[model samples]
Target: MSWIYLDNNATSKIDPAVLESMLPYLQESYGNASSVQHRMGREANQAIEVARQQVANKLSCRTNEIFFVSGATEGINMVLRGVAEAYRRKGQHIITCRTEHKAVLSTCAILEKRGVEITYLPVDEHGQIDLQLLEDSIRADTILVSIMAANNESGVIHPVDEIAALCRRKDVLYFCDATQYVGKQDLNLETTPIDILTFSAHKFHGPKGVGILYIRRKSKPIQIPALISGGKQEQGLRGGTLQVANIVGCGKALDIAKQQPHIRNYRDLLEREVLARIPQTFVHGSKAKRLDNTSFIAFRHIKSAELMTSLPDVALSTGSACASGLLDPSHVLKAMQVSDEDAFSSVRFSLSKFTEQSEISSAIDELVHTVEQIRTLSPVWKLFKDGLID
Candidate 1:
């Protein structure tokens, strides 16, 4: 049976146009971008530069500011670790939100072991951080404030512009992990006070294993020491040969995403239908600004894993793919003060531009059926129905 994929936040399918754009580099134009002494290498290097410009154009930043990395995970590690090491003399404090992706949180954990002080800001029930608390958290020793543009599980958008402005006033460098927000939203680095931004192409209909790190160049540029050292690529910031085909795919995918209409209409329709059809269901981050493609919902007394198993044709997730295998409640939900049982009952349905109205209808039917079936076996659900539990 065909699958109805609703996990775009985890990763999106590569667009056909992006695949076509990458074919030449993978086939005949497979030359090392660094080897400029030869014609083939020159062609490859030119392609890489063109792709870089494409990405830069989409982000509305200078081409020199973009650097290619393996993926967002590497980019996050590079920024957090590099800044911590390079500016060790300046300060050793880094502030980040508690609901951040494992990429940021895990890196911060490592930094903590190495004598770096990390302040994890809390989020409200709607999965938003307190702006005043954020500003108050800044200190003379705080060198960086890293926050995500959007939550991977809840899809709630953070007030990044306000956060950036606060960081600027405090003289703290700001880093935004835009992996889930980049292609879906407009973020012009030229106008924003963001010092460092990272995104992976796979999150936006591009191939996997390719990402971009935007380091703004200013009079007092944020210095980041090299995380990987080899052939002096990426201005000696990140090393290793460029993945030409993947980079080309990323550029084409980002260009397409920028041109496409926002998928909010589809997402809203899906959520409306699901909430109307499924009893005892509610949305996470409903009051906050969220991405147009994400819906994180919790069904009382229904385990998301069991629901997912019952609807094999519907490609949904309990939470972030990185932490899904751990069998623990979602860190994001826990941070928002969602109970452990409710967190386990929650599932994330992230749509893409390619999702159709028919698919949404079908997913809702399957989900409603699956949840009803699961609830039939749940004594907790029966007790709630009898008003035994509030």
Candidate 2:
């Protein structure tokens, strides 16, 4: 039987159109963008610039503000480290939340080791941070506030607009990780008041290894030290040869994603049907704003790893792909104050533009059967049936 692929948040499949746009750069136009002396190099350079403009136009920012990087992780490291170095005299403190992706949290951990005061704000039961606490956490010595646009595991969207406004009022630089939010929806940076932003293309049907970092130079006039120093690539801030094919694919992916409708209806049907079919299933971020393509469901008395392993035909994840192989509860769920049992029982079903209704139906049927079959072998499930556990 053909397998159903729902692990889209982990990474999307390459769109055929994006691949077609990138072919020339990979084959015939394979030239060093840094070497503008030759025809091939000039062609490659022009393509890269066009991509920059496309990215900027989509985000409603100037083309010069767009900088290319390997991926979101490198961009996060660059922005966090560069800003800390550039504004050390201003302050050594940075603010972020506990529900952020591992990339942001891990980078903050390193900054803490370097004597930077990192304030990890707490989240509510729904994985949303308290804006009042964030405002209170900002001190005169705080240099920056780094937050993500959405949660990768739960599809919970942070109040980025309020966060940006808060940072602006506090006179602190704000860096937003838009990796999960971008391409999934429209974000006009022109009026958002964000100082810096980062996103990856692979999340939106583009090739991997290419991403963009937007720095506000016109309005707020933000600047940071260079983390990688060598050539003039990325305005001498990031030094390395750009991935020509991947860059082309990145722009095309963003262009395509902007035109596609949200897959929320499919996600809703899946969530509604699963809850009706299962014994005790809960949806995370159900009431809050979320990506239309994501559904995080917790099945009580069921271990997600065992469930996923049993359903080989369904490509789903129990947590972030980075740590889903482990048996530990997801850190995102833990931050939301979910019990250990619920956390381990949750599964993330992320869809994409390419996903079809049939796939959702099939996956849901398989999930219902698997959850029921697995619970039959569990003492915990029996106790729950007997009203022994809540």
Candidate 3:
């Protein structure tokens, strides 16, 4: 069976362009970016800077503002720990959502143990944060408010601009976890008022193990203690030898995405066509303001994992990559108050710039057949007056 990959959200396949960009760095140009005396080091540094420029241009920010880290998980840890430790003298409170990725939640859990109070904001049925509640949650001791731009599970784009503005007005720092949104959507950080934003390269067709944290120069640097110490790498925030090749590839991938300006329209067609053919299936997020390349849908009476297994030709996910191997209901879905059945039946079909219309059509056909097959065997369906089994 020819497999169709629809799980771009978990981690995307490296694009040919990105892979090509990394060849010299991975082989002949291999050198520690920190080495200042050797030509090899200089070459690696040059490549790293070029990649930084690529990411900066995509984000509409200064290259220096982009700090490279291990990946989105590491980036979130750096920001959360940095802010909590550095500004702990000023405030002891932090706010985040119940639907945040495990990285963020785990970091918060650690902070809570260290005496930092945290508020997990609730989400609506569509997995959107309540702006009014968010505002109300911020207090004199609230030092930071970290929220995701696009949900990894539901594909719901949060009202980040509004949240950013609110944080600005209240003198609280705002951080956006855009790991799932970057490269898939247009981001103008200059006008956005987001104090900091985090993205991972693997989410956008680049190599894994590289993530970027965009820190607004004007914003007060959250005086957090460093998580990784030694070498003073990554501006002393994250210390380690930088992966120059992966960083270079990440930049190339962003540049490739930038050239494809019609990603929104392309993804809209996939959602429209898929929903048209399967009416009982519905998208998870607010359709109008989501990442153009993502769709999280529920297949009525069918389990997402079983459906995925039935169609060996297609690859997709029930939720985020970090949570995919487990059998629990998605935390994002539970936060949105989705029933256990609906949560179990949901799958995330994330497309990419390279995804063709024919591929989506074939996947949809296979998906329909798989759902029918599963429904026929479901004991729940046997109880129905009309078993619409195919």
| Top model number, lDDT | 1
Clashes of each: 0, 0, 3
Clashing residue pairs for model 3? 82-224, 86-223, 86-224
Question: Ranking by lDDT, best first?
Answer: 1, 2, 3
| CA RMSD of each candidate after superposition | 1.1, 1.3, 2.4
TM-score of each: 0.98, 0.97, 0.93
Candidate 3 has its poorest 10 consecutive residues by lDDT at 381-390
Which lDDT values do the candidates have, in the order given? 0.91, 0.89, 0.84
Where in model 3 is the C-alpha error above 4 Å? 259-276, 286-288, 386-390
Which pairs clash in model 2?
none
Please name the candidate that would achieve the greatest TM-score relative to the true structure.
1
In the range 282-363, model 2's lDDT, one tens digit per residue, is: 9987878888888999999888888999999999998687775666778888988999999988999999988999998999
What CA RMSD would candidate 2 show?
Answer: 1.3
| Model 3 residue 187 lDDT score | 84
Clashing pairs in 1: none
User: What overall lDDT, based on C-alpha atoms, would model 2 receive against the true structure?
Assistant: 0.89
